[model samples]
Target: MSRRPPARRRPARRPRRPRQQQEHLVGLLLAAAAALWLMATVVHWLLAHWWILLAAAVIAVLGGIGWWQQRVQRAQWEHAQARALRYGLPQLDALSHRQFEYTVRDLMYRDGCTDAVQVGGQGDLGADVKATDPHGRRWVIQCKHRRHGEQGAAVGTPELQVLNGTGRPVHKADVVVMVTNGRITQPGRDFARQQRLHLVDRQLLASWAAGSRPLWELLPALPPPRKPSRLS
Candidate 1:
């Protein structure tokens, strides 16, 4: 009997790589699904809370506007200071009563009173110029205009008494001042000294107007400068 030809052995079965490939594809699909779900959730939340986003946008806009306004105001104030006029006794002597009051207000601005204003007309109750100094002291100034410098009538105790009475109670002043391009009578000076009233007489006024020093430095016994707030 002829020996039967040996059957060729079946080729060895190849290892399956599709199984690992399928697992990787499934992992990728799952990750993609998770990312899509997260994005959808965020979109839904944003839609539901649209008003909060709108409010935030509005607040941001308002804050920007306020900041811009403040910058403009600061620029204007600095420009005013740069062009402010310097006055001499002769020029001051020529000014009318109302002009004198305004001059005092301008001088306060030169000395760093950003809020200096003239309020000397009728019903002012003796406070001619109102300001808050750089040191945070509230100043209520009463201007006494003199047409002829020291030869004019002296600022007397009656004026001081009126200012002292109203400076603190009515005008809420930390420092009350009587400014004159004239002399203060002896009695007026004594009253001012006793009541802690500051007097800017002709001599002092001359020095102040011609110098760069702040008015507070020339005067004594002023309250200490206020400390800044933490929030500020």
Candidate 2:
């Protein structure tokens, strides 16, 4: 029998640094900049004609240093932004259930899904939004609008069962997508991963809405389903 190696430990998350540390860093930077500026001023007073040249050189160096500092901290700023999103997920816009389904369908159309519809009144086992591409491929979607201060959870694995055709087709659906305007519980994300479902949470939708995502076409408004209805 082969002996198994012990699991590698994940790196410990670093504790957040103190606000004073950042202030200290900023103070030190400003001091260095002021020192350089003072030196430039002195050079101007003494060297006269050469002072303009010295000041220009110092300004250029300071600008370059500032730009480099921003570049170095860019990744940290992005991480902070993601953390902010996690804390403030509810402040994100959450649509009504039906409207959410339409927003999702519209996004898919932007991604080139020309035909899509919300699955009629199945409660949980039918695809919420069904779509097809020009190539004749089909896709199904589940939209979950997570409201603020509302529930213990929203959208689950049955959506896969739903997309899989309510236990009959057994994976006949070509594609399955799930969208939400808030964070999913860990179990929900895990379920999606285990069963091969796509989960588009708040950040993903906002990114799409803000034009961060590249898609073929987009309808700003979710159009009504093409099928004729007697009520209409």
Q: Which candidate tops lDDT?
A: 1
What is the lDDT for 131 in model 2? 75
Write candidate 2's Cα lDDT for 1-232 as tens digits. Answer: 9999999999997766777799899999999999999999987786867868889999999999999999879956754543332223443354567766766665555554546566635564656677765444456666667665235355565554455444225424555666667666677677766666666666666666555332212212222434453322
- Tell me the TM-score of each prediction against the true structure: 0.66, 0.44
User: Model 1, residue 22: what's the lDDT?
Assistant: 95
Displacement of the residue 98 alpha carbon in candidate 2, Å: 0.9
Q: Which stretches of candidate 2 lie over 4 Å from their true place?
A: 1-94, 120-124, 134-136, 149-171, 212-232
TM-score for candidate 2: 0.44
Q: Which window of ten consecutive residues has the lowest lDDT sum in model 2?
A: 214-223
- The sequence of per-residue lDDT tens digits that candidate 1 reaches over residues 149-210 is 89999999999999999999999899999999999999999999999999999988888887
User: What lDDT is reached at residue 151 by model 2?
Assistant: 51
lDDT of each: 0.89, 0.59
After superposition, which runs of candidate 1 have C-alpha atoms over 4 Å from their true positions? 1-80, 228-232
